[model samples]
Target: MTGWRIRDYHADDVDGILRLWEQMLAVNADPVYGLSDVLASCAKDHAVVAVVGDEVVGAAIGRAAHAQGWVVFLATAAHVNGTSIGSSMLAALESRMAAVGISKLSALMPAAAQARVGAFLQQGFALKQDLHYFERHIPVQREELKILAELGGRVLPRGLWDGVGGMNAEKDLLERRVVMPLAQSELADRFGVVPPRAIVLFGPPGTGKTTFAKAIASRLEWSFVEVFPSRLASHPGGLAGALRESFTRISELEHAVVFIDEVEEIASHRQGEPPSPTQGVTNELLKIIPAFREQPGRLLVCATNFIRALDAAFLRHGRFDYVIPIGLPDEQARWAIWERYIPDAAVDIDVRLLVEMTEGFSPADIEYAARKASQSALENAVSSGAEDPEGPFIEDYVAAISATRATVSAEVAKEFREDIETVGRL
Candidate 1:
């Protein structure tokens, strides 16, 4: 006869439950329910323990709903191997939960827990085949919502990452360098890859630097907070003190992606005479970055139209992991951008021609041209009093493209390529 006898779990048996949980992990029999859940069941739900005198060596925890009972946890101490203690505990746990009028008892365990399957079956449990488990964890918690609202941060919509049309090169680069490391941090760590804490996105104006920053935050499902230099300057502490306070509050969040667009305005090169008024702000930012890097699961993306104008020390090795270039869109990217702005109902618009014509246009320029074309078409159709006013025609778009001035001039584009070679770090 077995020396161990099954009984209802008591507060004194808590130490024994913890010991068994450790052994279960050692054997790769991963529990579906976490330790906290098992502990709660022992206190408020159904639990049974197998004890030899006052020392417990086995435990089974279960919880019941309207008609279903689930084995939350089950395990026998390593010292009591090749015995029926596990099966006995399961039987006792099931009996205790039966008061809830459960029609059936079930269990969810990792595939690694097969070593204990025999014990479960011995207790009249049947195994199911061809089953799988899927889980998704939301990044933010309810309690964090208040902190986020106060910080003027938000959780961007799910599709923003995918919705960012065109700029394939920039997208692919950020995905590998920033998103992959942060999203798959554990996997990255296995290969000795330190997840990036900060990065710089530099290019000419209207090249979609800010869009990429928001997309990175969206892809990671982290809070996105854009720090406006102009807005911070109006704070009572001035730009420097306000910047410090902003980051201090940001530390309260579990994970965040902080963006500072036009960072050059605050981090510009310190120059000449009695020093620029912005130099102190730049010095404060330099001090803030190291502290920011110490925290995991945070990324600071700073974008600048003029990389040359940024202070040298601001983009140093330890401060930012990568300084990537987001340049003008290519033909394929232009085609994709054009497709985004085109109306679904618009017929025979000859988009390929429009794409060909807007060779030097930016995303902002494309959006402007697309909207202008629709407005002009609507005005013409109204003025002529047509029976059915169709969507904007190719001729309307062509005129719009001709009228719209590209944001990046040839001189600016040339300087951007030069900055890419000299200033780009990726």
Candidate 2:
């Protein structure tokens, strides 16, 4: 029991299961077992097994075909009961099914295996009131499926957008200005609305501007590929040429939401005497935007903490479709952020009090305070060796909140307000 672990099924497990089944037979335990069936199940579907001391003790098999999934096999040695190995194997199988977009899973088992159904039930698998399993086997080319994975340059999980707790106005604006057009291109075109190609996200540092850019890509289900000026400066033809070459590669993808955070590194104002080193790169980026816009399924989202520092031409109407501001979270947004990071076990905690105390805090600042409180709570629990550890108390949160510093200083907030009044397009 000390060394037992549940893991993916290996090819050698076939013989091990056969041996286990033989041993069970001597004890008058009978199971509908066959070598060919087990072999085929392992080869064609998601299969996992429990192993203890160099022997396979249990197995669970599942297959996901499009949106429908099936649990075809489940077995565990009688000797391993109460070890929790059966439940773990079922969980692994369910996880694999969900990963591939399978929404529903059903199982059909022999009467002899009915005792093992408890494991599946414990893990949230429900008994279908009236259902039957049927199949129509079809040969598929596995290589063709690889093309789906290859199309996206850097596919981001859709869950990231959901985790971005606060900043509702910014999220709603991006959804309207960017996601709507791309997600409903056909409908947008019918309404004589052109899908947006480029937009600039401007705000003070640590305001979740970069997070919003990635969230937009996640919301659209498009690949996210960020272009870093620091890395591009090391390329052969210098930053300008590197910028050109990077977009050329990006253009190959069918759907992409490209990001350029801290874009001011290259797109800053071209000044005086001899001209800045960034001037040439800024020019190259200007030239790339029109060509990038010509492509139907692409969006170029640039983020800059210093909106005022960007070259005048770079943010002009023809160049960027919109210039949006992602300022500090409003009161409602702050409440959402607090709810997200606050631990559930902190029962009867005054969320409204926490929210009120967190005024003038950026999303990053609020997150920091929440984390610090959590860390303090964890440290207290560890030191006390308490079995049921308490969560961050109100006083603990106030202390953490007092210690944390806001990323957006007063001067920066004032500057951002000026930019919103003067430069913001939305």
Candidate 3:
């Protein structure tokens, strides 16, 4: 009565096929088809399915060659049990085989499914005897292989340090404090008798520590590994495993730069309180850092907002040898920062004046000033009802400069500078 419709196999049919296969195996003691075999057959063949409305009541799996007969998977839903569905599905397959000039038909069925095999035999098909199946056990090197269990599957693109506005002194400090030792073979040999020192970049918020870390990595043409502290705390025991996997992956690259941003979040010491979940994570990192340092061609750069809060042990000589402070951008650097922000804007404004005005401002502060200045220019153009409203004038910038205040207070900058000067003598 043509109650069922048959069509070629679609990729969407895989879940249905697998569910049916599993259901049939549960109903009957034996299953003629299995998930792996079905998948393998689909990989090698042009499969087809028999559908009654939206549901797959039956399926035919087979592969064809030029002269030889085709081997096919014939299966039907267990719910439609013993309704000649299997026979009909096999007949449809046989017709396709005959159209392809195949002289015989064959399939792999369990020895216990003799009734099903006899049904196929009745359809003018015979089992060939000469095929012998064998399996081999090939041991893979566990040490050399990397099985990355995605603790967190979200992939962020490796951040490039190209857009940082201005931090010349910080950049210069990093180049001397971190990059130079690693770049020179003699210096590396003289310093440790083996490897270069690991440097830590510490500063207050918005001081461009992460940006500086990326710049050092980029300048050295090293592979960069950016680790977010939050991600490290996501899993309970996964931090160590993830770190090991990451280290293994990084080792493949000749020169790798591993950057830990906001390092204090993970490695900071807990004072006047009990240890929390993240306390264990920092301890694990402390253990790994030494091993990481032992490995050649690897540079570890850690950035943090609060350096004083970090574990005293973590800041010791072997692990994070140098603690380079990334303070507020200096006066000349602020001027350069201003120039960067107002690239094409026509301004008779003195850069030194802008820099002096931004005395206690960080690099981020200077950039914000530039943005505010540009916005002021646009507002002035609009208010004046100028013919070309797009152009920002010098007066707009001067007004913007006059309006904004320094981000860091003079008292705070002086106190910080005093602390640095006192610490420098030690």
Best by lDDT: 1
Candidate 2 Cα misplacement greater than 4 A, ranges: 1-41, 44-153, 385-387
Off by over 4 Å in 1: 1-134
Between prediction 1 and prediction 2, the one with superior lDDT is 1
Candidates by TM-score, descending order: 2, 1, 3
lDDT of 3 by residue, 260-375 (tens): 88888778884545766567667778888888887877788887666667777777776766667777887767777778888565546666777777777777777777788787
Error at 417, model 1, angstroms: 0.5
TM-score of candidate 2 against the unseen true structure: 0.71
Q: What would you estimate as the lDDT of candidate 2?
A: 0.77
RMSD of each: 16.7, 7.9, 20.4
Give per-model TM-scores.
Answer: 0.70, 0.71, 0.56
Candidate 3 residue 53 Cα shift, in angstroms, is 55
Scored against the true structure, residue 61 in model 3 reaches a CA lDDT of: 76
Candidate 2 RMSD to the correct structure: 7.9
